[model samples]
Target: MANSNLPNRIIKETQRLLSEPAPGISASPSEVNMRYFNVMILGPTQSPYEGGVFKLELFLSEEYPMIAPKVRFLTKIYHPNIDKLGRICLDILKDKWSPALTIRTVLLSIQALLSAPNPDDPLSENIAKHWKSNEAEALETAKEWTRLYASGA
Candidate 1:
């Protein structure tokens, strides 16, 4: 889509995202659709996902800002907060979402989630049980999944 056709807010945000990208994160709008973005986020250091690169897709609907952008992981991950289908269990992505939040904030929140997985509020029941019962083992499994699927190799 042409820049002129998009909302001013989208244009400004897209430019800002390109010019001043967040650390360990990259988001670029698709040539075919300005509302669609291809994103990459490096796993935070000291997290089970460390040393891995995760891919994701983010789409801004016609009701963007008023409605939260749809986001999902393209890379396979093992986390209690992320389901097998890559649907995330983040509050900000759901009921806690607000128009005040930006794409940068949402991505940052996801990175923080990776750093602190909340098994108590999980999207994957089995994984949550594993996390609650044996955190060390769950962390190892997460690390192994990251290595196998998100290594960027």
Candidate 2:
């Protein structure tokens, strides 16, 4: 069974997200399942992903507030920190999650991750190696992927 307070928390968070949306990011709870959310993140400007709109899904579990929400990219992106499976290499999404962090903050952190990828700790070692070997080329490929896959969304 889902937590009794979960619905209230989800409702309040959804309302806040709709009322005061974050720049370059938007999320809405699914009508069928309030625990599921459809998210869109506008690629940050000045980055390789600029001018792209990346889709993502976020699912809050019954243990949410005690555990972090599950998030994964639906859009294909050529980023060192993002894997082929669309799992992001972010600490907050893993062991660093805190109950105080809201969906908005998580989205913002994801946006920040897009702006600054840490090749030292990457989801795709090949991409990380490419990034390390030739930064310009890696960035170009990322841009191409953004233009190819993420432009239409």
Q: TM-scores of all models?
A: 0.97, 0.95
- Clashing residue pairs for model 1: none
The regions of model 1 sitting more than 4 angstroms off are none
lDDT of each: 0.93, 0.92
User: What is residue 115's positional error in candidate 1, in angstroms?
Assistant: 0.5
lDDT of 1 by residue, 1-153 (tens): 587778888998899899999999999999999999999999999999999999999999999999888999999999999998889999998999999999888888998999999999999999999999999999999999999999998
lDDT of 2 by residue, 1-153 (tens): 233455677778888999999999999988777888899999999999999999999999989877998999999999999999899989999999999998999999999999998899999999999999999999999999999999964
Alpha-carbon shift of residue 104 in model 1 (angstroms): 0.7
Number of clashes found in candidate 1: 0
